[model samples]
Each structure stands twice: as structure tokens, then as C-alpha cells.
Target: MNRLTTACLLTPALLAAPACALDPQPVNIQGLQFYPSLLLGERYDDNYREAAYAAPSSWITTLEPRLRLVAEDRNSAYRLTYAGAQQTYHDDSSASHLDHRLLLEGILEFTARHRLTLKAGYSRLEETASTAIPGVNDEYSLRTFGATYRFGAETARNNLEFAANHERLRFHDDSLVNAREERDASRLGVTWFHRIGGTRALIETRYEDFDYVQPDSPLNSHNLALLTGAVWEASAKTSGRIRAGYQRKEYDDDGRDGLESPMWEIGLDWEPRSYSRFSLTTRQAYDEGDDGADAIKQTRTRLDWRHEWSERLSSTLFVGAARLRYQGLDREDDLSSAGLTLTYQPRRWLELALGYSHWDNDSTVDRERFQRNLYTLTATGSL
Candidate 1:
């Protein structure tokens, strides 16, 4: 059987074996819950001169399944969750492949002074794409494993969290007979939260390393990045964060030297009232090139607002824009996108959402535009 069939068959067993089953009163069965968000949409794009590029048409449907579980007792608790999703391209040619992703997480909570929790997770992503020769396909896959430890305070003025993630990617296809390489990435992060005189502050930092190895091409490269950021809550209605980072990359691929780049970000989160929320964020990033190529600089910005009108209906609007500047190639690109989402929740277990999005891309090399409209009707009931 396929992946979808396997998921459907295992749903029943997972629901029946929650953590609260061991308790005498059943504890309200509060640990495990399975909810799947089904998505369907249509997309259209104009202008495609290259046949190698995959262009979207006007209709597509996607299915995503998400599950959450939390088992707790007096001194210890365990949690497990999984998410699986797939999207098939009904492309302008009907000759494309499907994209699939799977993720699993496990957590262990220990009762201590700081309330420490340990986590381990794994994720896999696979993609199928069309090839130059008909009936031939290109497939790529990535697998990731990670761990995290989080600590919190019940009534004190301190919180600490640390996490580490390692990811590996492997690419294979029928078009290229001997085209396989391994890409590994490692990330470490730490965050501290402090409360002083009713004012909340946070400090966070992270380091990441990426390495790529290829035996056929005899190429090896690594990039190391460091970032630090701080957040402060001035009032109930206003909060913001700022971060700065630097990266150094070294390569042994065809006489490529070392390079360094810097990046920065600013973000704001605000709530005007109980029913309205808004956010504004912007980032500037630079990336070093491989094989003696010129570096790239990118800038991104976004604005999002959500308003709840009533108990049954709520609307949200978002705007995003991005610009990219390339060195040596003298190419400049810009993109602007807007999205609107409306949600209808008439019952505690049922919800319906409708969304619309439009994207515009303009560049010195090419110009393209696309519009996506989606309507989702969902119902969920459990006893």
C-alpha cells in the first residue's frame, strides 16, 4: 500500500492509546488529539518561455494530516506528534510529480525546579519533478533529526531553552545516473527570558554549520553562522525584537576561497485590542557563493493583520515583499504578494476557511505573476 493508505489505517490505533488511559478517571482523555487540515486551491501564472520550468495551471488539491498527543502524570510526561502532507501538481502540462513531507516528534517532560523537557524529532521530505526526456523524472529527498531541551519557571523571573538540530539531504534522479551528494546542517540555539518590574525581556543566540560533500565532483564546503537577538515587551500592546548575525564560508571546490557575510532582522508584534493583532517584520541577509562566484544580498519585509468580527466570522490580511540583488551578474529581482483569509467557526469542533493570494515578480531577467484562490470546508467531531 501507499503512504496515504498506511496513515489512514494507523489513525485508529493512535487514538485509542492515549496517555490518560492509565488513570482511573481517564483524566478527560486530554493527552492525544488528531486533527487534519485539508487544503484545496487553484493557481494560475502567466509567462513561461522555458520548457524546463514547471508552470502551474488553475486547479489543485492538497491533503495534510496533523496529530498531537500529550501524556502526563504527577512527576513525568511524554508526548508524540506527527504530520504528513502531500501536494500533486496538476500543472499546465499534467506531466509533473508530487511533493510529500513527513514529520515526527517525541518529547519527555521531567518534574524539576526549572521544569526541564527533552525532545527528539525526525522529518523527511521528498519531491518528484519532470525531466527533459518524457517519462523520466527527477527525485530529491531530505532527512533530518534534532533534539531540544526547554526549561521554564512557574512564578520566578527566569526561563531557559536550548536546542540542537542536524539535517541531511540526499538527491537522486533517473535523469542523472551518478548524481548523488550529501548535505549536512547543524544548528544550536539558546534563549533566556527574564522578568523585571513587570517588564519582560528575552535574549537569544544561535550558531549553525552547513557542510556539503560530493565524491563525484570532488567538492567539499562548509558554512558557519552566528546570530544574536533580543526582545523586549514595553507594554501590553507593543513588543519588538532585533537580531544581527555573521557567516563565514569555506570551500575546497575548484579553487574557491573563503568568504564572510552579515545579516540583520527587525520584527514587531502588537495587539491593538482583544480582537485585533498586527505584526511587521523585515530582514536583510547576505550569502557567500561557492566555486568563486559572487555573493548574493536579499531583503524581505512583511505586514500581517488579523481581525475578529464576531463569533462565527473572522478575517485576516497579510502583505509580503522581497527584493534580491546579485553581485557580478548585475541582476535585480523583486516580489510583492498579498493574502486574505476568512474563517468561520460556528461550533467548537467545526471550522471553514476561505483564502485568496496574489503574487507578482519583477526582475531584469524575467517577469512573472500568479494568483491563487482556495476554499476549504472542514468538519471535525469526536467522542
Candidate 2:
């Protein structure tokens, strides 16, 4: 009867269920906002590389196009997005590929709590290589800028926030995984909130900095964190955000050795009825390692379920797990996954989906142990 008293006695039957209509409803012009999408898919993979021995299987065909644009007012907001893809493989034609992404995001609310946020992105990817080397086609670019300030007001019961952020990452192939890890990251934070009936209690402190571009890279790092958190919403039929922390990572390379961990992030959401819904997530982190490990300490968990068995049927389920550790290598990895999806939205812009997934990896190095299975079929439209 623990687990926070069984999640506070199941939060009133998960907030009296009912909420799920998974997004998508946009299209307007003149006030500018649009969402256009098209996807057609087919996939089957029983293990394409991810090998522990003779494993190669494939059948793929996918075409995707997506777009989103938005514009807002009153304070300011804007967004732009695009996604493109084309994949074909039939006998694993060199793992056929073409992918692209573009994004821009913004927000500026100069007053009513002050804010500014902006992001930029570009991507082109194709990857597979969890250690047996060989697999690449990556291009990346990203930028972010942020600022926020808020303090008391708007029905304040003590609230405060201060944030700062800067990020940059770029890589355009630097000799196939040996030195293409460019990076720059920065963060500074402060938060404090208290209001305890219907919950909201938070405390945070953060500082992070990472800079690298092969400066004799051992993944130069710095991190410091401290957190304590809570956020709950009951009448909304359950809501969650949880944090717990103490993290420290420092390395300026002396043959790598610096870490002090115990960090966590958790999330939960529930809607016990009215077409069912449930979600849970967890994390513990320290990452920046892509097979040339010098850092990677991860723990992840996830669970999700959704159901809407009428008005055009729906279903979803997923489960996940992960654990990896390697920071100067003694290597360990374990991963597991499960998935299911079924959807049919007979109208309102149509959609059809079917999916299945399974993956397993357990390694202590053995060609990175592997197992995989995936099947998918999809169709979507909305313009």
C-alpha cells in the first residue's frame, strides 16, 4: 500500500476517464495555420543487421510528407515544420533511404511573465550501427535559444522561475564516427513553486555545459543538478510530473573518470475509462556516446496504453525498458521493447494503421546481441 499510497488511491479512478482524440485538426488560412500530412507505409524487418550472427531480413517501402505551420497572436508564437521521407528496400538495397526534416519554432511573450524561446533544426538521417561499426548517413544542425522569467502574480502562492538556455550541435560527417560529434550545450535554471492543495511543489537547480569538437574529446562535460518535484492535477482526471535528483558529471579528461549519479524524471497520466488511457515514463540519464563510448549511463522505462473501441476503432499499447552503462567501457546493455498499434479512423481526414514490434538486445558484447521484429502497414491523409 505504498507507491504513494497506490497513487493516492488511484486518483479518483484516473480522473474519471475520457480524453483522447489524438491531435490533428488544423487547417486555416488568412490567420495562417495548417497541417498537411500524407504517409503510406509498409515495413517488415526480422532483423536487419543488429546481428549476433547471420541476420538480415527486410522489406520496406515508405513515403511520407508532412508539414505544419502556425502563427499566433496576442503575445507571439510561430512554428514551421516539414518532414520528408522515402525509403525502399526490398532485398535491403543497401538499406535505401532519403529523409529530411526542417523545423523552426518560436515564442515570445514579452510580459505576462516574460518569455522567449526559439529553435531551429535541420536533419537528414539514416543510421544503424550499434556497434559493429558500419552504417551512416547523418547530417545534423540545431540551434536553440531561450529565456524565461516569472515570479509571483496571476494567483500566486509563491512561484518563481528563471531559465537560460543555449544549444548548438552540428555534424556533417566528420569521417565516419571518429570525430563528427560537434557540440555545445548550455543551461542554467532555477525554479521554485509551492502551492500544495491540488499540488505543485517544485524545486530545481541546474547547470550544464558541454563543449566539444574533438578537443581531444573524451566528450568534455560538466553537469550539476538538484531537483525535487511534484505536480498533480486531479480534476483533470490525473496528471503527473515527478523528479528526484542529484547528478554530477565532470570530465576534462585525465583518462576519464567522473560521475556521481542518482537522477530521475518520471511522468504518469491516466484516464481509467471513457475509452481508456494510461501512460507512465521514467528516465535516469547521462548520455553522449554512440559506440565510441566514453559516456552513457542510461535507464529508461515506459508504458503506454490507449483504447477507443468505437467511432472508428483504435488501440495502442507499448512497453519498454533499457539500461546501458559504459563510461570508459566495461560495457553493458539491455533493452527490451514491445508494441502494438491498430487504428482506423474512417473519416475526419482518414487514417489506417497496423503495427507490431518487438526488439531485444542483451549485450556484454557479442556482436552486440540482437533480436528484432517489426511489421507495419499504414495509410494516412489530411490536407
Candidate 3:
């Protein structure tokens, strides 16, 4: 069934249950619990011939609305969220169009810790002048039933969860040629808290399986990803983490070789002063096809620094660079990005931020040169 019908059928009955209800609260006539942000931005990306620069010179705007209603009892919770964004861009110097998106999502949680939650969501995306290039994605739906299991400290103290998600993707070009993908993903992870030398540390690890659904014609592929990470804190002002992961991707209909990639990273953090903190990170990854000789290598290094001038003003600066090499490709393209964010928070619940980013890519394919500049402004508030 569609999201609207499912919501209509489940919302009323679910709200009426006396076993799981929240504390009573006054309802806002506007249904406005909070507003996250009103964001506006502009970007320019050139050199579509060689790199992943899909568009050039685009303007953007976004608004996200959130609401929550509490019942009189202690067992039920309801949340509603909506987002709208629009973009206008120039394509190939003449083909230009505006794309708009609307998304609506609702969640109802019950039984407190048991947390029987149901979600209904829908989104509509439309492009004015593009037909073949992902113009519109209409009618996506999700249904999930999930529960958590908890164990005491002696055996394992962690939250275990299992969820099955059903999603439908309808393409604008062929309305009837719809795709339905379902995944049963589970997480087995552990978290630990410790204290040593007057400081506290937290560690976590998880393994997940992402299963997919395809039509009888065998139109898709599915795979598994393994994620593991650890964090250590030796002092009140210093902490760091190490992470390693692997993912395998396969596609049946594409007639291309499957891919397996592994990545590892290590990082360090330091707060030399109360007003500022710095972090450094390095990562390496390798992507290989079934044929071992055909492989790609990537290395990334980054540094970030943030400072607070006062209670109401703060700023952050980040710089990063990546080098990627693909087999059989003689020339390698180096990518570099840097950005700064300045924030003004006059109140605890409200904030305003402005950001700018610049990226450059030099490609060996015909010596193509690509560059992009982005500027953004955002204001967010909560009550």
C-alpha cells in the first residue's frame, strides 16, 4: 500500500492504545515543535568531460520542519519531519532547469524501551527540462518492525537490533518499470566505557549485513560490509580513534566484474587550550576487481581546527587532500578541498552559520581541469 493509506490506517488505532501513551501536553495549533534550519547556498562546478562535475553554477535553498506530539500516558511517542529543497543549475551552457524536492516522514514509537516503531514516508522530485538524467524520483515507501535486546554487564551490555526495510524506487522515464528493494539488516555491536588515569574512554564495534531484493529477471546485486572501530582517551582534553572496514559490491545485470574494497584509518586529537582544538587523520584504501591485477588505490589526509572566541562566536577550518590512482590510467588526479565555518549562537537553542568551500581536480583525461566553489548560510533553532 501507499504511504498515505498506511499512515491513515495505523495512526489512529496506534494513538488510541492505552497501554503505551506519553505524558499529556498542550498541542500547538501550528504543529511546530521545532525548526532545524533555513539554508541557502550557491555552487559552481566546471569540467564535466573528465571528472565527476555534473553541473555548473547552481543556486540552492532548503527548509526542514520538525514536530512532535506527546500523549497523556507514558507509552507512545509521535514525531513528524518534513524537508523541502530546490536547485537551479546550468547544464552544457544551454540546457538549464530547476529541480525541486518535497519529503514527508512520520514515526510512531510505542512500548518505550521495546519501542515498536512504524514509519511512513514519501518524496517527490521533479526537474523542469531533464528527462533522462534522474529527473524525478516519485513514490518511495518504507515499512519497518524492530525491537532491541539488552543484556546485563556480566555477559554483554549492548543494544542489539534487527530491522527489515522495504523500499520502492519509481523512475520518471518508465513509470511501469518500477524497482522494489528490500533489505534485512542487523547489527551486532558492543560498547564499553572505562576510566583510567582520571579520564573516561568509550569503544564500539559493529558488523552488519545488507541484503537486497531483486525481481525474477535478476536485475540487481547485494553484498555485506564489515565495520570495526575503536576510540581511546588518555586525558581530559585528548582522544583518538582507529577504524578498519571492508565492503564487497556485485552487480548481476551490469555484466561487470564485482568489486571489493578495504579501508583503514587512524587519527589523533588534541585540545591544547580551552578555546581551540585540533585533529589530524590519515586514511588508505584499495579497490580491487575479481582480477587481482586490476586495482585502484586511494590515500586521504586531513586536518581540522576549531576555535571559540567567546560564548557567542566560534569558527572552524578544515583542509583535506586525496590522491587516487586507477589501473591502466597513466595520469593521476589530485583532489584538494578546504573550508571554513563561522557560527554565531546568541542563544542556547538557536544558531547561525556561514560556510565556504573550494575544490580543485586536475584530471589526466585530455588534461581536463575542474574546479568548484561553494558558499552556504544556515540558521537553525529548536524549542
In candidate 1, position 56 carries an lDDT of 34
Q: In candidate 1, what are the lDDT values of residues 1-383, reduced to their tens digit?
A: 01111222222222244321111122235454333333333333232221223443334445555455556566655556665655444553343345554545444556453444444444444322223233344344556566667677544578787878766655464433314234566778887767665554666666666565545343345555566666677888988887777766566566766667687788998999988889999887554322122445668899999888986778889999988666546566687888887777665544556777766666665422323333433332222
TM-score of 3: 0.55
Which residue pairs in candidate 1 collide? none
The TM-scores, one per candidate, come to 0.70, 0.32, 0.55
Q: Is candidate 1 or candidate 2 better by TM-score?
A: 1
Best by lDDT: 2
lDDT of each: 0.54, 0.72, 0.50
Arrange candidates, best TM-score first.
Answer: 1, 3, 2
State the lDDT at 243 in candidate 3.
Answer: 70
Expressed as tens digits, the lDDT of each residue in 1-383 for candidate 3 is: 12222222233332342211112233455544332333444444343222343543444444544333433234444544444554444444233323333223333333333334345445454432212233332333333332333222222333333333333433343433233323233334444434444343445444433343434433244544555665667776888887777766555547656666776777989999988999999876543211112335667888999999987888899999987665534656687989998888777656678888877776665433467667777766554
Error of 2 at 156 (Å): 19
Clashing pairs in 2: 15-237
Best-performing candidate as measured by TM-score: 1
User: Candidate 2 lDDT, tens digit per residue, 185-213?
Assistant: 78889989888887888998998888877
